[model samples]
Target: MIEYVPVIESPCMSLCVMDEASGWCLGCGRTLDEIARWGQTDQADRDAVMAALPARMERLEGKAL
Candidate 1:
């Protein structure tokens, strides 16, 4: 049997502040919907998110977000 894992598991660090500009979690780069529904998603979904992290971080650094 194969096992699947999630790349992002709601990066909420108790800050829970919604970024009005992007609607993204303040702590984690995941969207609110992602945080709301993590356990249900499959590894593929997480992998996708993981793949986007570098670009996302780049964006963050580029814009200093």
Candidate 2:
């Protein structure tokens, strides 16, 4: 019997800088809690976090502009 493991990709860009104001990673747009729990989270949870990343990144970029 073989045990199957789900392989979910990480959003890390190798630039692990955290934005103090938003508490989000500057590169991946994931919160510290989210980043920490990512490997343990299910697909649905990971998807939810990925879905929110674009907006989070947008907001962060807007602040820089």
Candidate 3:
């Protein structure tokens, strides 16, 4: 029997612009470290980060999360 694992989708929007003031990517609102480590993270961790993205983007864009 084979065990199957789900793949986590990257948050990249392909904008790839870095916001120097916030140190986060303008497209995905992820820090360089987060982008770097995302591929190696497990599903639970990826989910946690995904859950937080909306709030982070809202804050970065000066909107309510």
Candidate with best lDDT: 2
Ranking by lDDT: 2, 3, 1
Residue pairs with colliding backbones in model 1 are none
How would you encode candidate 1's per-residue C-alpha lDDT over 1-65 as one tens digit per residue?
A: 88895355544567566667777655556677777667788878877876765665466456663
Q: Residues 6-61, candidate 2, lDDT per residue (tens digit)?
A: 77799999899999999999999999999999999888999999999999999999
Tell me the lDDT of model 3 at 17: 80
Error of 3 at 22 (Å): 1.8
Instruction: Give the alpha carbon lDDT tens digit for every residue of 1-65 in model 3.
Output: 99997766999999988878888788898988889899897779888888988987887788323
TM-scores for all candidates? 0.59, 0.88, 0.76
1 or 3: which has the higher TM-score? Answer: 3
Best by TM-score: 2
Count: clashes, candidate 3: 0
Q: Is candidate 1 or candidate 2 better by TM-score?
A: 2
Give candidate 3's TM-score.
Answer: 0.76
Q: Candidate 2: count the clashes.
A: 0
* lDDT at residue 2 of model 1 (Cα atoms): 80
